[model samples]
Target: MALLHRAELRPSKLELLAGWLPGRQWFAGEAGAPVSRVAAYRFDDPAGEVGVETLLVRAGDGPVLQVPLTYRGAPLAGADEHLVGVIEHSVLGRRWAYDACGDPVYPPLLAAAVLADAGQAEEYFEVDGKREARPASMTLTGSRTGRPVPTGPVSAGPGDDGVTVVRVGDVELAVVRRPVPADVPAAGGLAGTWPGQDEPVLLAYAR
Candidate 1:
């Protein structure tokens, strides 16, 4: 389960993304275009230390983009290159957010989810020191695979179109960074559904 706190965020998530997204090499939006978040999903950190969330966003009428982020209480060691920015949370104090593609904690968790056919983590909110269930904004379904969970840090390789190859341990996972036609199918992969979407959208494939 993913726990959320009712808190104010400095600079806000969208505000930060507006400044960061345009700089990405794969960004298809016009420079400085306003970006809006369409939907999001979260993955549980087994240790409950890091916050892992994936945001689906669009800038103006540009293509939908998938950006996964990891939030940490302190800076992740040797992850300066992946740092998104530092933000202050009204309840959790300061947090350091990084792009999950470069964070060591993300790929292994993703691999475990895909291998286990796990769903997105359920979310809860903290109120008066008590936990209250909240609706999950997104749902994820992973294709079942009998392979053992992948381990070790993830490595990136050349990709075609908007699909990127991320290696986790000995397994190669293909991540779709851009949204494709709804009818497109994957032989074996991770799929997700968000608010207003009737069909499952492919997110990643395990090879």
Candidate 2:
């Protein structure tokens, strides 16, 4: 289960992405465009430390961009280049945001989603002493190919033509930036349907 808090952020997630999105090699959006959150979903960190969430945002009229993020209590060492930014969370205090592709904790979970059919974590919001289950904003489904989930730390290469290749041991995954049917490498990968979009779109591919 994913536990969330109703808290304020000094620089909200969208604010952090507004500055970081332009620099991506795959970004094809116009300058000074409106960046708004479309929807989001979370994955639980088994260790219960990191906040793993995938954000879908639109910049102007461009295609929805898939921006997976990891929020941490401290800076992720050696990931300075992929660091999105630091923000002060009203409840969690200081939080470091990193591009999920560059974070070590992301690959295994992504592999599970692609090969093992793992779904996004169920969410619950806690306010005061009360806890209430919250529905997910989106529904994600795995390819369910039943292959062994990739292991080992991932080292991501630079984004090229809107896809980032993440290497985990012997498995290589193509993480799509702009989720589209054409980005699906072969047929097995993680696919999802969000609020506005009922048709499934490719999110990542394992090859």
Candidate 3:
């Protein structure tokens, strides 16, 4: 696939945040909450459609949460709607931003992040690399319980109907075919007692 050109993006990262942050599960702002730029930065991406951002927002109370989100076009089915947002990239112009769990370029990007701690020789990438795509998966080891997470289907391999984990030394990158939703709690209260009750009412991402 052809990559997007960088010359098409805008210069303001804050402007990107202004439209991006509210749609995150970790965001603690009120509905349509006004975000006063606390701090922010962008990530490098080989593919222009994907935009990564680290944002700090002082919402209601406690210190700002450093939210790292990978934005791209469209929402991952069944994900919290907050994960999707349209931002004008300094290079790719207007594009959606969300998690990189399902993106093809993520394997390489992920490899870079993991290799920083695990060493490049120990990093790996997984993809289909064909006309048809299969699901993608990832395993985060720092977590207390080290387990694999199948991120769902990705592009199939060159001539195969399935995907492959291009291994690196002892490290193996397996595409998580199915992602488990984080244990989340439903919103409480009948109606009037809820906070931010007077906003563009929708389901809140509560854990």
Per-candidate Cα lDDT values, in order, are: 0.80, 0.84, 0.37
Ranking by TM-score: 2, 1, 3
Name the lDDT value of residue 181 in candidate 3: 24
Top-TM-score candidate index: 2
Ranking by lDDT: 2, 1, 3
lDDT of 3 by residue, 42-99 (tens): 3466545555543445544433444445666665555454344555666444566654
lDDT of 1: 0.80
TM-score attained by model 2: 0.94
lDDT of 1 by residue, 1-207 (tens): 999988899978878888888887767776688888888888899899999998999877888888889999999898887889998999899999998877777888778766767768888998888999988777778867677887766776546777767788887877778865344234357778877875888787776
Model 3 alpha-carbon drift over 4 Å, by segment: 1-25, 29-32, 47-49, 60-62, 71-83, 88-93, 101-104, 107-111, 114-207
Better of 1 and 3 by lDDT: 1
RMSDs, each prediction? 2.0, 1.6, 15.8
lDDT of 2 by residue, 115-177 (tens): 777889999998778889998888887877756777776788865678888888778888888
TM-score of each: 0.91, 0.94, 0.36
